[model samples]
Target: MSRYPLRSTLFFLCPLFSGLLACFIWAATLPPAAAQERGGGQTPSLGFAPRPKESAPDKELRFLRDSTAAAAISADELLEDRERKRVIGRGFADLRFLGKRVQADHIEVQTETRDAVATGNIIFQAGNDRIVGSRIDFNLDSERLVIYDAKGYLGATYYITGNVVRRISVDRYEVIDGTFTTCEGDKPDWAFHSRKSTFQIEGYAHLQAPLLSLRGVPAAALPYAIFPIKSKRETGFLIPTIGYANRNGLEFSPRFFWAINKWSDATFGVDYYEKRGSRYLGEYRYILSKDTAGQFNTTYFKDKLEKTTLWDIKSSHISSLPGGWGFSAVTDFASRKNDDRSLERNLNDRVRQDTDTRLELTPNLKGIPGSLRVAMRRREGLRENDGDLFQKFPHITLDVSQSQIGSSEFRYSLGSSATSFYRVQNKKTTVLQRFDAAPSVSLPVQTVPWLGVTANFGLRYTYWTDQKRTPDVPGNPSRDDQKQSPLSREIWFSSLGVAGPRFSRVYNGGFGPFRDFKHILSFQTTYSYAPAMDSRDRKLIIPIDNVDAFNDQNTVSYGIVNRVLTKLKTGEGFETRQLFTASLTQSADIAEARREQNLSANPRRPFGDVVLDIQSRPISLIRFTHEAIYDPYEHEIDEQTTGLLLEGGRNWYLGLDRTWRRKRSRGRDPQSGRSDLNFSAGYGLTRRWFLEYLTRINNVQNITLQQS
Candidate 1:
């Protein structure tokens, strides 16, 4: 047993010992050799596997490999065929190239050709555009895509759907069998369907064979059309205006605008009235420079109901020239086939058609301190029964500045004019030529801050050439007579002297809403004198204007003025403003006393009417004005005018006026007077709504004369 046990034990122990020795040798030798073989004779460590030594070329190669991996396209599922250089992906595949992204349920890419195809719910996104298509074929390098059955959104306001769409560039696209609409819905409010369309980003869409549909109903068709997708100024059709008027009935006006250039534009409009006929209107606007702008408009209408043709032309222009010269012209001319009854039905239109036209040019004299104005004017009446009309074809005037007399206080000025007047009545014409000139000199003296005086002396001369008039002619006067009189001349001299004294006082810290209040009082007296010409000689002069021979008279006019000023705080800053002005004027005619021209067989009274004027702005939004002439000799009010204006909240305004004039002679009733009351109000109801009313009432008759 002992021998067997020993042998068995020895056998187990020997095998165990032999296995442990072989394991140690195998472990020690195997690790070193394997490490040498794997790491190029480098020792292995227990802390971590020894890092392989990298050379410059290896480092560069590894960096390149990592960059390539980063730029490579990734997908959830990818199937690659190396031989064909093709890749196929399914289930939520997405690819990004450039700045755009493409997503689809299934995608196929050709690596060599740099092209891709996507099907089943494909979406493409670039910039603000997101396009969805059933199938898409795109070139990766070229960034060109062809989408089938695509619907895309441009910005947020526009939508486009097409059977096929080709992306030409980032800002351009070509669509076939497409519909474009600004409205968002399955059923759009308005849409344009085109067989072929080309879109340019933020510009316009060119459509071939476009049909305009409203509420899914085809409303219009065009061979080719350009739809503006921008808010900038472009040549296009404007929205039509539709309304109904009582006089003109239903009206529809459509306009077309043409942008000629950056400085000019034109609009052509057509207005159709159901009761009346159509009207064509055209307007042209231009701006040549900063100081030059103009507009010309014309309207032509043929009324079928009234069987009349009406036309009106209006033009206005203002231009500033070099060397302090300016030009302005306004022309308003209208013509009708018939009388006022057959003219425009609206009162405003009738008034506009009867307006006058004028043109003026002002030029600065080079060496002289003056300006010259040349004007042309024309007028035509449209009333049923009107009298003769006087018109000036062209008028020229010169106004010179006041010149000093060698540092003296005396200044002189000259004003001259030449005018041609034409009078037409009952198919007859009369012409008159007149020339006038006036020169004046003034001397102003201020002895102190409260005392001032001004003396003015003037001479006026007028010459006129007119047809000779025969006295005691039994029949009507013939304006076509060839007889002419010699040029008549009238000369007059006048002098005026004014002396005044002004006084003012200021009070502070007492007035409400005003920091300082001032009161100014002034008293002035004016004395005018001229030698009268003979009455018989004055009868020979034909007056064409206001200049006439002076009457033999010595007059003294006295005026008293009171003005109130205040310094107040406003929203912007401190302001100094005038609050009210009150004035009273009266004159005494001394020459009437010397002539003894009193018809009442009483003492000759020299005192004339006393004029009272008051203008007051008591508050920021209210104004009151009163003017009256009181006859002190007769102890009566001759004339009176009063006005009140109120500007309130919510853009509301109200104005009231009262006027009264006394009759010169009392007929049966001593209190007979003519009086009128006018009331006007305007209110803004809403942002785009307004209401205005104006009415005049005759006080004596107790009736409304006019209301608008």
Candidate 2:
């Protein structure tokens, strides 16, 4: 058995010998290039790898291949030397396989661990972000880049630092013993520093620290914090606002946001006041589609016996209708809670029953394509005083018209409307109930020259029901039903204006004895007349109706005189233009002759007002106004007002205003003739410093000052 085992062992040894001989022959026959290709070195492989030598141009990037000071070197975008390779560059040098760069004065590369060790002004740009350090060790095989004594920018938004940094990904990193700052790059605030942080390159970060400094001065330390740097819909706790008020005392409001979706969101918050207890509020808004959107807000509070709250909700929708029509609707509602304190003690009197409603719809309307409109509105208020308590009956209106009605004559037509009033708080007052329908037809003759005349006719009917107090007799003129009965009437009228373009010219710059400056001015005039109306006198008038006696006339003489407009351009970004228009106006009153004789009063002077417009480029504003009222008959100024504004500069502004009035002999206050001056000023000295002042001085030296 021993001999047999020995024979097996010998057979195995013979093959092993033959294999060794074959290897020796192969190695002896190989070329020198082949040996070198196999990473063979002239010297025996040592535990320490040799360092690469520095390249020329002294300022270029070079690599250290070993711990020794001198070694062979390779200068390339990529270096692949087994002994070792390091970059010595003034700016930057990258080790490709290691997936790292060294921006340092000196760097040492090692093959055992396959890492580049850096020193002196070292920076590593890995992926999108970068890091700076006094020293660094980067591992190519592990794709791990680490730094010590580091500071640099994080994705361009925040300045970051850590005693050690281990980048997990292009967008993710782990920072130990770190600091965060708003200063970019290597700049330091010196006031703000962190102990530890985990940051995300995608606009968020988680921080953990015992204390954080502001401007390098310690403010407060937080155990943990989560911040979002991206501006978008994000859910988080918001900064709290705090203030002191006489009624609420020291109050703090903290809000929270909920990121719902791209089209909708919500916000909720709470108020903690020292004297007023706590209050909660919520607001929600969203867009349903391209043409539909709405918002709602509500607030609630608590008390012992009686709690008061208010909720407001509003919604609107715009929809495309069949044909070329469009539809729009808006709705709003408010509800209030009332209890003992609110009603009896008047602590919260404004919470009493108050409701307002409005609804409208249109089909094939004018101006708007394809519109017809039907709308109703009502409002009610409950109050303790008879004069304060009031109610509005549902006022209904229906109107239909076309945008471009006729070719030769663009005619617009309107249907009548109906409304009624039925309630009054005072028992001595009678309820007013009435229905009115007024239909009007307007035909405007037009041509390419923008000159034409128009004719209009309107018919109106009113049904009225009058009530009387049950107190006195008719002869004595006490409230009686005999004189207050129902009345019905129909009124008709036709109006015509032979309107054609009336053009006039004017010359400006006649002021300050400077006739040298000239300007062109234009004017237009319109003369209209209306035939006598059949319904001149009436037993009753429509409630909630705008009295149009101001716009009526037998012959209205209106001419736009001296339409003066100014034009100028300046490089200082301040351009001002003023347009002044004057017109003679009057009301058409067929019964004016009788009213003047019977009333025994001054005949109303043709009521007229001059229009003025001013546009300024510096402040980017347009103003339409009328300030000076001249009594043409008396040849004196009745009322005057002046207003001006200036807007420019980063933290500066200015404005001015003045007003004056004349008192009449019959009805005038003792101090009515005095002029009033009101002015306000504000300025921002710096980004964080602001100042504001307001003053109102009457003729009696009643001066008011406000500041911020």
Residues 1-708, model 2: lDDT tens digits = 000000001112122221111100000111122111222221211222323444221212223443332223222233345444433322233233323344554555665555567676666665445667788776544555678887666655456678988777656777888776543223322223457777776556776653545234564545555544332456655444445544446767777777688888887888776765676778777877775666666656664223445344555556655654555555545444332222121324345454455555555544543234455554444333313224434555555453346574556555545555544333423355566566667776665343566677777666666523232322112223423566565656566654445454445543431232223333344444443433423312322345223133454444333444443444654233444444433333334533555344576544454433332232233233346666555666767777776654535566677788877666666336757776766664322223455455675446442211
Cα RMSD of predicted structure 2: 21.4
Tens-digit lDDT track for model 1 on 1-708?
A: 000000101112122221111100000111111111221221211111112343112222221113322112434566777799877766666655545767777878777776889898888777766778889998765657899999877543357899999999987888999998765446655577999999877666788877766557875666665654542346655545555554567777767888788898888888898888898999999999999999999988888877778777889999998988999988877663435332243657645424467888898788777779999887665544244455776799998767887787889889888888886555566677778888888888887888887777877776677634643321223564523574544444555555458889998764776678899999988888766655554554444446533345588989999999987777886688888999999999887767655556867778988999999986778899999999887798989999999987545899999999988774546567899999989864321223577678899989877655
Which candidate number has the best TM-score?
A: 1
Q: Local distance difference test, per candidate?
A: 0.68, 0.49
lDDT score of residue 568 within candidate 2: 43
Query: Model 1 misses residue 16 by how many Å?
Result: 99
Which parts of model 1 are misplaced by more than 4 Å? Answer: 1-260, 266-282, 299-311, 321-325, 335-355, 384-387, 425-429, 467-483, 490-492, 548-553, 571-573, 597-608, 648-650, 663-674, 685-688
Residue pairs with colliding backbones in model 1 are none
Task: State the displacement of the C-alpha of residue 8, model 1, in Å, after optimal TM-score superposition.
Answer: 99
